[model samples]
Target: MKRIIIASVAAAALVGGGTAFAVASDGTDSARSSSTAFQATAARASLSDAAHAALKAVPGTLDSIERDHGRWEADVLGQDGTWHEVTLDANAKVIDQRVDRDTDAEDAAEAKALRNADVSATEAARKASSGTVTSVEFDDDRTPVWEVETVTNHKERDLTVDAHSGKVTQAPADDDHGDDDSGDDD
Candidate 1:
């Protein structure tokens, strides 16, 4: 009798453990499949004309369109000669726009400024170290600012320069460090 009871209990434990394992595995697989299906469905929807028209006003070809946080983000080029990051609604209507101006404008402004309190590109770059002029634009106050991306001492940095004074208005250390050196290390 004792032997029979022990055998029954062992068998029951084995069956229960197997059942639990199967359930957990099946749940994970189903969740992944469903998420993939949803993404595929969303991708099939075409962009609306309103979105295209808004982007057309900006310069450069459309680089990419992505669905982000219930909004569509379109990256376009602007006449000012820099990339513009635009956000649109799901229906393809413009929600917000951020203009990135060319660096040349800052250089030219800095040079002119130095000649006569006029800002020029050389002076702006010199003040902020070396980086490609990405964009130059005026804020609401009409203060011209230059945005630059550069590498110094092997570290990448970004700077916002006052176009008139050729002074750094803001400087932010880049978090994306050692990216280019990664592949070489391996």
Candidate 2:
């Protein structure tokens, strides 16, 4: 009876130890997930703020804006028909500005689209959805349109807004179209 009692206690202890280890590992995973979610939230907020700041500093049509390595970079077509590459700090402060004089065929196409656009980048983004705008650019369609990429509830979505009419539509999938370089680069 004494030996049986000792064996039962030892088995119970072994099972209990395994349970504790599993619980601890699960808790660590949960903590990591929480941390990652928090970082994404922070990045979304900063991107919006930085975009606004970039437009204010450059005072032109915003072509594209993206966050890279803790900084925000914006490509803007100035009112004077010049392209400006604006870089801002994480705090939305302007840090660098450069004029892109090397205009390629793609650049010319984008500029033409922007010129024909009745809606601004901000308006296109607003019409796209009530989500965090990650990037916005002109699509190389025959008709002027804006491609707005957004993130909502951790899901990414692509939307196209008519540059002339402000109409919004779902963007086409990669496989849905062929390499027809109609000047629309998504």
Per-model TM values vs. the true structure:
0.29, 0.65
CA lDDT, every model vs. true structure: 0.47, 0.72
lDDT of 1 by residue, 39-148 (tens): 11122123334346456666444433444444566655444446677876645667788865554665445333323434433345457655422223232124545554
Tell me the spans in candidate 1 whose CA falls farther than 4 Å from its real position.
Answer: 1-45, 48-51, 101-186
Compared with the true structure, the alpha-carbon lDDT of candidate 2 equals 0.72
Name the runs in model 2 displaced over 4 angstroms.
Answer: 1-41, 44-48, 176-186
> For model 2, what is the error of residue 24's alpha carbon versus the real structure, in angstroms, after optimal superposition?
25
Worst 10 residues of 2 by lDDT: 35-44
TM-score of 2: 0.65
Per-residue lDDT value at 110 in model 1? 36
Tens-place lDDT digits, model 2, residues 31-71: 54333111111232355577788878877788877666556
